[model samples]
Target: MVEGIFHVGEALAAGDVAYLVQAPETLISPFGRDLVAAAEANGTPVYPVSAAVMGAIADKDNPQGLLAVAHTRHVALNSLGPASQPWLVALVAPQDPGNVGSILRAIDAVGASGLLLLDGGVDVYHPAAIRAAMGATFHRPVVAASFAEFAGWARAGGYRVYGTSAHGRADYRAAGYTPPLILLMGSERQGLTAEQTALCDELLRLPMRGRATSLNLAMATGIFLYAIHDALDQQGYFAARAS
Candidate 1:
């Protein structure tokens, strides 16, 4: 039995453990009572805690009085499974949990195979990051490795690494995104380091015309991913006919 496993009615109904507080009403506003009762009927344990105790661990500002402490799921980095091409996304030197989570979500949305986080990047399991991911962290494959290890592996695997930068001349839209590609994104304030930046086959940037000097890290990552998807789509990624 997990010590911190709390069960809210809906989470239980959904066959998942949930942490519940004294006022079930607060937790069920979105889920409703019928769903809560069904969860309880389905053998989902609802462990209620005092408001003070719950407040201590819950995200107070937006706590739904519901949470679940469960084992973290792990996904290996190398095996992206069957696809027209393999794509790896690297979160390098990112400190913000939200940005990391958002990047993970974008990676999943674009159906990227693997996610690699540099040593100095934000913790993938951080609560804030998990929330920002909107549950994508659970499904996305990820690995943590040093730049040297990744460079060696990428080289051996024939992966073309494209690093995102403010100084790069190549526009991402114009760049070719072939199979076995590694897309590297950097920190919010400082971009990639000299060593990491040097490892990339090409450096690319998003075109910007607004007053802001550049785009947000998450937005930039999404743009690059969508651009790749577009490129692949144009090349008849899943068409029955051969290109």
Candidate 2:
């Protein structure tokens, strides 16, 4: 379910299957008009409701005039293969929905392949996550799996898993991010478990000079993703994609 004009617009632009859209009678933004037009073009029903009614259905503190109900899209873990240039972000037992959503947004920004949720933390479909993602959730595939199941799949697919840790030997910038790579992050409260870290082909750490000992999950993931993207780009990853 997508709420607010911005999110609804993103869902429509991404070609998500919308079942219905509801808007207040007072909605007059050009963006809202375009959204209504697009929904109607795709044969989706757009219902006009009272502002009070809209408030009851919308989840935001400042509810926008638009809301959309759309189908969830995800692929099974078994469906993943050893495709060329695969770059994936895997979260193990992520604790916060907002963090999950922010991470998804970052993943989209870096043009990574997709996201993998291992052993389940927050529901990917949670409204907070969906809102925080700013429609990125619609832009990429998100898969869920257990640690053991994911480990088996990664092995079979020749994926090099890179786990993050403060005590890691290799600096994040120094690590090699080859194709078919997986950036594995642990939960907020607890970092990667012993078993989880043990499975990684390489353990990486971000340098910290300040008094702060750690970064938030979303921030840390973003830093790692952009760094990996830069490193891969320098190695002709983007050039290969263009060809």
Candidate 3:
């Protein structure tokens, strides 16, 4: 289920199979209008409910006057293959739904190939996750796999695995991200195990000067993603804009 005007509109734009849509009669925002138009265009029923009814059905504290129940699409791990300049983010057993969704948003922002969820973690379709993603959940592919399976796939696809660790010798900015790179992040509580760390081609770390030993999982992942994005841009990854 997708809630909020932003998420519901994104779901409609992404061609998700929408079963129903509920919105208050007083929704005047252009976003809400676009959602209704899209739903009508696609033959999806839109029900006009009162604000109280919307509150009862919606999950968010401040409902955005829109909600949609749609099908969630997932990609298989084996189906993913290497590209000429692929960038992927792999999360291992991420505990927080908000973090997972924020990471997905980051992945979309950086134009990464996709996200790989390893082992067990929060469901991507969870309401909190979907809400936190702010519609980025509809923008890219999310695959599920085991650590071993992901490692094997990364090796076979010639992807350089870069794992994050506090004890890593190489600084994150100084590390070279080769083409077809996969940034591996561990869980919030227990970080990547020694065995998992061993699988990485290079382990990178973000320096901490303050009393805080580590950064939030989402913040850390965002930092790495943007750093890698800047590096790739410097290497001419993106095509020059025609002025």
Which candidate number has the best lDDT?
2
Per residue, candidate 2 scores C-alpha lDDT tens digits across 1-243 of: 788788888888877756554555657788888878878887888888888888888788666677888888868988777574399999999989999999999999998988999997899999999999988999888999999999999988999999999998899999988878999998888898999999999999999999988999999999999999999999998788878
- Which residue pairs does candidate 3 place in steric collision? none
Question: How many clashes in candidate 2?
Answer: 0
Looking at model 1, which ten-residue stretch has the lowest summed lDDT? 1-10
Model 1 Cα lDDT, one tens digit per residue, 159-219: 8889988788799889988767889887677788898898889999877787888787888
TM-scores of the models, in the given order? 0.78, 0.95, 0.93
Q: Any runs in candidate 3 off by more than 4 Å, and if so which?
A: 240-243
User: Relative to the true structure, how large is the alpha-carbon lDDT of every model?
Assistant: 0.68, 0.88, 0.86
- On residues 87-199, what C-alpha lDDT tens digit does candidate 3 reach at each position? 89999999899999999999989878788999989999999999888888888889989999998888999999999999998999999988689999998888889989999
Which sections of candidate 1 miss by over 4 Å? Answer: 1-25, 30-45, 74-85, 238-243
How much does candidate 3 score in TM-score? Answer: 0.93
Which of candidates 1 and 3 is the stronger one according to lDDT? 3
Shift in Å, residue 155, candidate 3: 0.9
Model 3 residue 127 CA deviation (Å) reads 1.3
